[model samples]
Target: MEQASSNHTLQAEIDALKASLQQTNSQLEEAQYRLEEANDMIEAIRSGEVDALVVKGEDGHQLYTLKSSNLAYRIFVEQMTTGAATLNRQGTILYCNSRFASILELPLEKVAGSVFCDLAVASEISNCNELMNAAWVHSGLKRELNLITSSGKEVPVLLSLQAMQLEEGLFMSVIVTDLTDQKKQQQLLKEKNIALQEAQETARELNANLEQTVRERTKELYSNQERLSRILETMAEGVEIIDTNGHLTYANLMAQKILGITQSETDDHVYIDPKWQAFHVNGSPLPENEHPMAIAMTSGKSVYDFEIGMQAPDRERFYISINAAPIRDEQGTIIGSIGTFTDVTHRRKSIQQKDDFISVASHELRTPIATLKASLQLLGRMKENPDPVMLHRLIDQSNKSLNKVSVLVNDLLDTKKMSEGQLQLNKTCFSVAVLVNDCCQHIRATGNYEITYEGDKDIMVEADMDKIDQVLVNLVNNAVKYAAASKQIKVRVVREGKFAKINVVDGGPGIPQDRLSNLFERYYRVDTKDNHYSGLGLGLYISAEIIQKHGGKIGVESKLGEGSTFWFTIPLA
Candidate 1:
């Protein structure tokens, strides 16, 4: 029974083992069939044969579907205006659109499988490599670079690269765009800027030239104005310019001096003011309207030799002669007036003196002529039966009259010669003491006064002896005539340093202070109402001239009540 039981157990074990092996073979066949179906499905999907798939899960039955959309994507990329391409991770061109091949001037077959970096210009290959490396980390990379076409031409292009990750490997999608139009526009803009700069430079040069010309012209005008001002200042006559309104517009240096107006005091309106005191030639008060410049302006005519007396601000009077003429414009219309002034005080005085001298000389000549005629008539009467003593007295009277006439003629001749600067002197070394004593002897013989001589006995001087004698005689005669009441005359000579001084003192009513300054002037005399003096008033004048010719000075000292002393000094020998 034990053997039979063991056999059954073995048989059971075999049966079980067979059943397990059959189950393992069935599982292997199902795995093989499923893998074949999976591969076949993949192939069908790629070939566009299968369109749908179904998968069952715990939630429910799920349907998964596949569509041939790559055709649409391929069409879109092929028809794009921009070039499109695909690059492997190694930067090799694996696939490219028709537009990409057209841009590079190459066939699509040739563009694919070519190194993308090799298609770029040699200088831009490094840029392309950098772009490809950036594409691995970044989603998109872009750069502007030049591409080398199949014809060996360099064309500028904009390249865009994008990174795509797939189970096969990492790929880069590249897009290229032509940059020819953009470069042309930039070149045009640069040319326009250069042209603008050139135009600005030309304008600056023109402005500089214009400024230089203006400066030159202004400098020339200033120089001319300065020259005109110098000419006006150097003129001798007092010139004044007035406007039509009688206002002084311009005055030279001489004009300011003549008018007694200082530079600080002169103003535009001062010369035309009517407040100044002015007189006409006839001693009547002159009105403003009658002024030379004013009359010239109003009448439009010249006024010549219009004399007027003007009192300066210091109250000193001046005799002025003016000649004024209207200054006319180019149209002949009076615009202003110009006047010239001359001081004529001395000239007028000289004319008056000549008139007075003529009158006095006529009277003097008449008196001498009357005396001579009386003497001649008496001689004629005595011609019949004249007593000798009476005839001698008449002849003596005639001789005295002739001497008086001869002295008068000589005095007149001396005066004329002195005025003409032709008076000649015969000079010698002479004793001043002798000159004084001789002059006093004549005066003492007249017995009009007690004449005395004092001082050095032998004072010698270098002078015209005859002229000195004449001067001494005149002084003594004057003392006798004027101081006869006092009956005293003194003649003195002294050596003062290098000079010999002579003095003639008289006890006479002293000269008036007002008449002292005029004592030495030609033709001047002390006019007394009583007519106590006679003869021409040329004695003192001639005396002064003679002393001056001898290199001497003559002067007087006197008081109204005290006596008069006339003195002179000459260089001692």
Candidate 2:
């Protein structure tokens, strides 16, 4: 019984000890909690969150006011490039800087006291709440989200949240960095990277197939070269290639024909010789250095449409249009020149003829007009005087002037009709010899030369009588006009086979053999250095066309100092 009593007393004493120990532990835990709270307050104060402090001093619970640093804080918040705003735990905006208001496109006063979550896109409202709640627990939290503005424009932004314990309440600080421009730059960079990757892939593929592609390209290149050669050979324009030593390395068929070059004559300098005598379009001498090929080689540049008049070795003057370009090696050194040329002789002559015809037509038309005007004026003045003889003379003069104008207009009209294939013919049976005699009557009346008609006067032919008369008259006139030194003109007609041949012979300075081929071409005239004849150069051309329409042939035979025989053949009736 004594052992039990001792054990019970010991147990009660141990239980009291345990209670005391538990109570002491609870006091220590409370003190620790207060210390943590004090530390938090101290941190808040240090961070300028506390506005005032209460201190227990000698005067007991003295209150002191802290100097305001709101100005500095406000300046820092407003001056920040990123948008800054203060929000409550519920995500209600309490204050916002100018930048924050600008990001939302709203006024600071309007944004304050507004729910910040309203600015977040509808899809991101829940995400914004989550971030805000997390920020309250965690000091710093960040998220990328889209915010909707008053104008319905969605702006991408980086929202950085920081919770602060201020004197007033626990508020969250938000930093909104606009990512619009950054997003655009990132998109652009992504596209460029994709392009670069594609290019790299293509390069790898090309490298892998390089050998086969090269072989195929080489075959195609040869085929193209052969096709090009054939085209160059058949093309109308002349093409020639010269080496660096000024030697003709290659000449197409057209080039050889145009330059009158034989296979053995391969030297380029032959053309630059004094005998060739090249001249510029302006009639100035073209030196060897001035030739298009030479200029292109020397200057290492191209020459375009350089017109030059070159006299062939046969003394035939012709014009050529040349285009030349320097051929360069892989090192960009001019190796030689490749030149193309076209025979522009006919074009050049045609141009000159047109210019001459214009000048001649002006003078011819003006002469008759002036004479007619003067005659009319004189007749007007003599109207009241009534001088019969002067009146008759003036009337004749006016008639002659009008006739000249009529002839010129008719020639132009006839030429135009022939060119348009609109010339109509009225055929009839007529005597060739009779037609010649009648046509020469006017020239015989002039008495400037002796006109003789010796042919089969009864030789009949079916043809347009008026057109035949015109051809005969034209031939006689040409003989009388060109054969100034000669005193005789002869017209002959004869029957050969089924045709009657007519000939008009002249004895004067005859045409050059070189000019006979182009005699009947339109606008072609015999150029005389001493005198310019008064005509449109259409007589021979018209005569040729008329003879052709009558199913006949017309031509001229002439020698330099001898004379000319202009003849035509018409089928018999």
Candidate 3:
């Protein structure tokens, strides 16, 4: 029993020993947990996420310290490092990044602690303070400088700076950048600016010259247009403008009158032969494909002397001569045509009358005048002295024959003067009474004609005296020549307010009213081809010109069977 009891108690003691050991182990584990907690707290504080930090002297005295920066805390730095670096305001490095140490070709131990200016500053600058202070004051500054490396090599560098507050003092973060490539770029840019300015100035000069050229060309064009306009307006021929569609765009004064319309009342177009309702001179309508102007426009050619008659609806017609040409644009495309027209009606009629007059004049006067001239020449050839009365009678007959010759000669000369517009007058102040007396004396010398004169020598006026005398002589001579059967010829001069008038009265076959309008026209005669007259029909026209030059007027008042009174007026001096 004692042995068994001893074994049980031993077992109990063993058990109790084991339980106590277990308790001791539990306490030890608790203490170890506490130690681990403290280590974790220290690690958390060292991470720089918190403002609190711990630092001490080697002798255990506290030294200068700083709280975590708000920027550093915001960045959540799990690792901390202090490297040799500098930054400009833009965060660009002046010295270098932490990676600079490897490129320095030096032991990293010294490289990490070196100031960036010591390696990268240009050699010309002894101190970096001048550049750094300026950056600090302005917050942003950059300067180029020369610096010497530790090995005595000179380098060009750009020093860019910014201000930073650090543990030691206020410092400007200067960034050192190499300027070798930048110097070359600046030189190239300067050269480019110089070339650009030169090009711009050259362009300005060219623009000024071009402007002057344009102005001069415009002036030349204006002058040409003016000359062309004057020629078109003043030419005796009529000119008209038309578009490609054959519409009249413009016309001169003569054209409007020829077409029988006022300027404003004219239509957009007028046909060359307006009598045709649809088609006239051209294909479908006037100025269509076959028309002269249309052909010129389509072919780019000029056509001259196209005949277009101006006969309206009536048979009473007139002739027109035409010249037409095409107008083209810059690209040589046909735009329109210009047509010039000249009326040839009066010319054609006058030519026909001239032919008839020559034939009639040759037949009528040649027989009578030729016979008289032959007889006179025969009488002169035979040198025979006859009785005074017989010689006087023969002389009188010769004088009559000579007078007939003089009439024919005077008619020829008068026609030549009037047609040439060369009949001149000695226009001067003269006594009209003297001119009248001389004319009267010549009329009295013709014993076959009876004369009557009125008005006295007191009448004075300004006139071409000789021309006025010619006019009076022609009138009186025409009366006697046309009416040798008349009983008497009356000449009279009367004064009206500011003027004087003269009249020559004779009994002769008067003119018809219808022929009176063109009575004074050249080559026109009252007697037709069958009943030929003695004169060339130029006497009356010549008389009219003389009176007109003397600033006088002439006309005839006649009844076909009764008589005619030729009258004239002269302005008083």
Candidate lDDT values, in order? 0.71, 0.74, 0.60
Scored by lDDT, the top model is: 2
List RMSD in Å for every model shown.
45.2, 30.0, 38.8
Global fold similarity of model 1 (TM-score): 0.54
Better of 1 and 3 by TM-score: 1
Provide the lDDT at 166 for model 2: 54
Model 1 regions lying over 4 Å from their true place: 1-229, 242-250, 268-290, 311-317, 327-336, 385-400, 440-442, 481-484, 528-532
Top candidate (TM-score): 2
lDDT of 3 at 59: 52
lDDT of 2 at 351: 68
lDDT of 2 by residue, 48-114 (tens): 4774333344555433333333332333345344577777666766566676787788876677657
Candidate 1 structure lDDT = 0.71
Report how far residue 298 has shifted in candidate 3, in Å.
Answer: 15
